[model samples]
Target: MKKSIVLISLIGLMIACSGEKKESTEETQITEEEVQNIEQSAQEIDAVIDSSIQEIDTLQNEIDDLLKDI
Candidate 1:
């Protein structure tokens, strides 16, 4: 019968459209050495920025002293 055929076709379509669940096969991890390297790089960058700021402050003070002399 046409109705039985249509019912069977709908059931096959549903099974084809259903998604399968999959488990993750591998886990990702960060090593201690990588963490230490990142921390060290951050500290070096901070030191460079602090030194540049101090240099700028010193130059500004020199300019102020020169203006006072004039």
Candidate 2:
């Protein structure tokens, strides 16, 4: 679910950054810095996801150990 959500959000962001952007009353464009920032943000998100999965696995192992004792 988290991956799906992140994928969707990243896809949307990529689409938004892919083409010329113009506001209704003004001209606005996606900059190189914005794209770079998005890339960094995605990396950070992946790191958080990795850590979260690891924590969940650790907790699950602890739970399984307890179940085995009982």
Candidate 3:
């Protein structure tokens, strides 16, 4: 009958849609974890840059003192 065919088609459609929803949720979770890891790495790099700048400033000051003595 036409009614049975339509019912079966609806069931199939629902099952297919449900599968897509799960896949989307899993992908979102993976993206969020990656974003968090990237943020942590960025923070670590910023700290290293700050430390390097401080070291350069100290060396420059020492050089200026030597020049003053000369």
Candidate 4:
């Protein structure tokens, strides 16, 4: 009877461990997907920043040219 109890306890522990592992794997997958989405959004924002900088530089050059004419 004692041996059977021990065996049952071990089986229960194994099942619990497996469940925890599956849950952890699912969480990791979700985190990776979120990271990828954030990276893509950051890249889009960088592109917008680059475009704005170019426009500002062009305006600065035009202002400099007008000053030279004065």
Candidate 5:
């Protein structure tokens, strides 16, 4: 019957859709080496930013001292 065929097709479609959902929910594992590499890169970036800020502060102080003399 047409009704039975339609019902079976819908059930098949639902199963296919549910399999895709499970695949999407599965998490990708990160290795310990990958985590360590990420941490090291972050620390390097922080060090560079801190050094640049210190340099800017030093230059600003020199400019202020010159302006005071003027």
Candidate 6:
């Protein structure tokens, strides 16, 4: 009786483990709209970064000019 109980418990555990593996192995599918949206977000981020770099360069040049005058 104990042996049967242990065997059944082990089988139940195995079934639970297999179910989890199937869920974990499933592939995620992204739609084309999602891809386009990601690309647009990336482009927006790049534009922001470019403008920030230009601003920093302008600030650095002004600082250098002020130092030269002093």
3 or 6, greater by lDDT: 6
- Candidate 6 local lDDT, 1-70, one digit each (tens): 9999999999999888886444566789999999999999999999999999999999999999999999
Model 3 CA RMSD to the hidden true structure, in angstroms: 11.9
lDDT of each: 0.97, 0.97, 0.90, 0.90, 0.95, 0.95
Better of 5 and 6 by TM-score: 6
For each candidate in turn, give its C-alpha RMSD to the true structure in angstroms: 7.8, 19.1, 11.9, 11.8, 6.5, 5.6
Residues 1-70, candidate 4: write the lDDT tens digits: 9999999999999988886343444443467889999999999999999999999999999999999999
Summarize candidate 1's per-residue lDDT along 1-70 as a digit string, tens digits: 9999999999999998896878898898889999999999999999999999999999999999999999
For all predicted structures, in order, the TM-scores are 0.54, 0.62, 0.55, 0.54, 0.61, 0.64
Better of 2 and 5 by lDDT: 2
Candidate 4's displacement at residue 29, Å, is 8.7
> How many clashes in each structure?
0, 0, 0, 0, 0, 0
Q: Candidate 2 lDDT, tens digit per residue, 1-70? A: 9999999999999998999876598668899999999999999999999999999999999999999999
Residue 52, model 3: Cα distance from true site in angstroms: 0.4
Off by over 4 Å in 5: 1-25
Residue lDDT tens for model 5, 1-70 = 9999999999999988886344576789999999999999999999999999999999999999999999
- Candidate 1: pairs in clash: none
lDDT of 6 at 37: 100
Compare candidates 3 and 6 on TM-score and give the better one: 6
TM-score of 5: 0.61
Q: List where candidate 2 sits over 4 angstroms from the true fold.
A: 1-25
Instruction: Give the candidate order by descending TM-score.
Output: 6, 2, 5, 3, 1, 4
Q: TM-score for candidate 1, please give it.
A: 0.54
